[model samples]
Structures are given as structure tokens and as C-alpha cells.
Target: MGSAMNPPSMSEAKPALSRRRGRIQLLLIVLGVVGPMLLATGMYKLQFWVPEGRSYHGELIGNGQTRADLGVQADEQRWQILVTAPKDCAVDCQQLVYLARQIQISLGREAGRASHALAAAQPLSADYAARLDREYPQLQRYPLDAGVFARTTGDKAVPQLWIVDPHGNLVLRYEPNVKGKDLLNDLRHLLKLSNIG
Candidate 1:
């Protein structure tokens, strides 16, 4: 017939059109699900959409050193806040220890997810050590080697603080004079973002 020779009928065209429409709909559905994820990844990697300035409050160590390099066992599944003083527990040293305690407490329900320790340059006086135990029963005490302290902070005589990640990397450092709230803010941010710790 003339119609058969001329072209395909509308009814015959319907299946092809339907196939194309189905493919387009499937493509759109896939893009709807995957496009945002790809965009977010790109934005994060390029730092394009992220807010400017440091997202955290601590002084980043930038050393890339792990706990093993510093002689720690480095086996903790939780995060650790470590304070080291040049000498025995002095006023500032005691204050730093108290700050660590407060920081852990501020974590609230996440408190059990963190640990605290003090590494003294010299052996703490038994009386002072006992007092620390009484006041901060959860704080562990260690004697820090002068070389280790010097290597860590580039100044063996000054009191310093460190934050160790769950993977044992030394990530942040703080001076003895750092505000408690700032340290707490950084810890809270890290814990919230971290999946491993």
C-alpha cells in the first residue's frame, strides 16, 4: 500500500518514542541522585563553596608525625589530649591539666570518646601528683624526655599541649596560655567530623 511505502505509522512510531522517553527519564533520575553528591565532592575538594578561614581553632602541627615517633604506644581507639610541661607541675602546668579535664567534661555524651594525659619534663612531686590524682582521677601522668619535648615543640622549656587523632597522628598543638573554650571548640568540631574516633 502507499501508506506502507510512505513512512511508518504513528502507532508504529509510538514504541520508539516511548523507548526514548523512558531512557530520558532514567537519565534524569540518575542525575538527580548523583549530581548533588558529585557537586559537593568537587566543592569540598576545591574549597569553592566551603567558608573561608580555618574551620578549626587549634594550631595545626603540620609535622605529620605520629605517636610512635614520639614514643607513645599509639594504640588508642579514642582521641587523646596531651599536655607537657618543661618541669614539675607548676601553676601554669596545673592550670593546663585542669583545662584538659574541663575540655573532656565539655564533650558531654562524647566524654568517654576522649582521653587526657600530662607528660612532665621532670618527675612530679609525690604530693603534687597525689593532688592531681585526687582532683583528676582520669588523667594519666608520664615523664617526658627533654629531647622528645624539644623535638615536638622546638622548645623544651615551654609548656605545650597536643591533640592526637584516633589514628595516632599528632594533629594540633597549643600553648599553655590557650583559652579553654577555644580548645574545647576544636575538640568538639573534630569529634563531630571524625568517623574513626
Candidate 2:
């Protein structure tokens, strides 16, 4: 009776302890593999501890729209600073165009990685066309479709600049009044972060 009632012997206890240890080790392995992924997903969904400060000065285009959506063909495989004028290239539009070129020039060693372009809804005035031809030798030109521009930009018909990626994806948009220095900084930041054009 005493033998029958004796506490579990060491030999019998060994297997139970081993099984418990194995279960604990398995649980730890699973946690190590999947813990961070779950935590990251939770943080993204809850917007917890996310940084409030952004480095970009322009409005981010996160709607998955591309240059094609603006009715402009993507011929350049490099990063493009495209100025879009829904109306005639007036004072605001011309200023944005100049800003775009200046920003590209400020890139210095990275200049070849980027190009400046203009998309105008109406034909340029002869004097402006002559000026563009003589002064802006490297500027690319495109015809802007007003109908598509209206659909894409809603009520915003003013001139704006777009930072387009190599894959033709629209990254950011800046108003006509955006400063050249600020735009240069933004483009530099993008070039530094991106491996592609």
C-alpha cells in the first residue's frame, strides 16, 4: 500500500518533466518567429507610436495613380519632374516649369537621374515657345488632355508639379508656389532613399 501511494518516482517524473520542457521550448520558438510580425501589424492598424513629422514637402499621392492617368505618356525611364498646366502656360505655369528645371539642375551629380518636363493643355504662345526652345534646350514637352486632367485633379485646375518615379508612378504633387529650395530638398531626399530612378 505504501509503495502504491508513494509520490511519483524520479524515473516516472523524468518523462513528464521532459514533455513539459519540450512544450515550453516549442511555445518560445513560435513566439520568436511570429511575435514581431503580429506586433508590426497591430501598430500599423492602430497607428500607435508612428512618427508625426514627415520629410516630404509635397502632398503625397497614395491613390496608386500614375502618369498615364494624367493623359501623358511615360517615355522617360528616369525620375521626372513634370509640370502640368491644365490651361495655357501662364505666369503660374511658367514659374512651376522654371522651378522644376532649377530643382533638377540643383541635383548636381544626380542630375542625369532626373529630367524636367511640361504638359500644357493649350498651345504655348509663339514668344514663349521661342523662349523655351532657345533657353530650355533639355526640357521635354507633352500635350495635356484637359478632360483627363479634370477627372484626375477634380476642381484643382491650377498648375502643379509632379514627382514621377521610373515606373511612371506619381509620388508627390506640389503647388505652383512651392519654393525651389524646398522642392530641391524633397527631390534629393527621394533620390537618396530610392535605388531606382
Candidate 3:
């Protein structure tokens, strides 16, 4: 009789042990799959690790100003490559203008996806204006407010390259010294990521 009772208790204990083992195995499997993912996500969110590289090369405009606010009429369906210079486009200014035109041209099959625009705080010389029209027939001209862009570019009216999205938002600004290759790389990346512009 004692042996019979012992056998029944042992049988019951076997099932309890089996269930405990199963629970532990399930917990370990969940941890194995989800642990790394959670750690990676937490690290990313916490900014504990920085990305190896950045996609865009231009300086971001923190104020979030747009073409509409500046009174520049841009194509609502295409990205804009905007060139800003002082009243008179001297050699340096002309170089920036040329850079803008070349950047648009370098887009190749996607060339039509972007449009070029020139803005000056002061009016350009008649001769230079005519030359610009003749050389870059696709360029759109706008008179920029010195006070408006001045706040962003500092006191001096240095020629600057600005990227405007389809919604007319002024997003990126690059210095005149920026390399053509850098401009191309940024534009390519923007076109790839953006469905609108």
C-alpha cells in the first residue's frame, strides 16, 4: 500500500516538473528572439549610438521658412534649386548661378523633376540679366527681400544654394564653396527618398 501511494505522488510530481520546464523553455525562447531587438531599439531611441554616416550634406534651416512666406512662386509639383546672390552677380555670383544650372542638368533623365530659380537682394545688371536668360532659359527669376534672407544668411549677402521641396518648403542651404559632387549626392538622395519632390 505504501509503494502504491508513492507511485501516484511520483506520477503527479512528474507532470508538475514537466510543466515548469516547459514554462522556462518558453521564457528563454521569447528572450532569445526579442532581447536583441529591444536593446537595439532602445539604444536607437536613446541616441546612445550615432549613425556611421549622414544622407544629406546641406545645412538645415531651423526656422522652417518656405517659398510661400518669402513671396517666391515655385512650381508646386517639382523640387526647386534656388540661387541667391547680391544685387549684382559678379564672378563669384555667376559661378553659383552656373553651379545651379549644372546641378539641374546633371539630373539627366530626372532633370525635369527639378526647376531652377535665381533671387537677388539687388537687381542684376542688364547685360548679366540678358546673359542669364540666354544661357539658362529654364531659370525662374525672383527678387528676394534682403531683410528676409539676411536673417538666415547673416549680415553679408553671400551667394547661397537652397533646396525647396514640392510644397515650397525651404529645407536645405549650402554654401557657394560646396562641391558639385556633394550637391549631386544630396539631390540624388532627396529624390530617392521623396515621392512628392
Count steric clashes of candidate 3.
Answer: 1
Tens digits of lDDT, candidate 3, 65-165: 89755545555579988887754677777887898899999999988889888887788899998998788898888887777666645656678788888
Kindly report which residue stretches of model 3 are placed more than 4 angstroms away from their true locations once superposed: 1-14, 25-46, 69-76
Model 2 gets an lDDT of: 0.92
**lDDT per prediction?**
0.81, 0.92, 0.81
Worst 10 residues of 3 by lDDT: 68-77
1 or 2, which is superior by lDDT?
2
Which candidate do you rate higher for TM-score, 2 or 3?
A: 2
lDDT of 1 by residue, 32-135 (tens): 99999999999989888786688667788676897655544446778999887766678888888889988999899999999988877688888988898788
| Candidate 1 global TM-score | 0.70
User: Cα lDDT for residue 46, model 3?
Assistant: 91
Taking every candidate in turn, the Cα RMSD to the unseen true structure, in Å, is 5.0, 3.8, 3.5
TM-score of 3: 0.79
- Clash-forming residue pairs, model 1: none
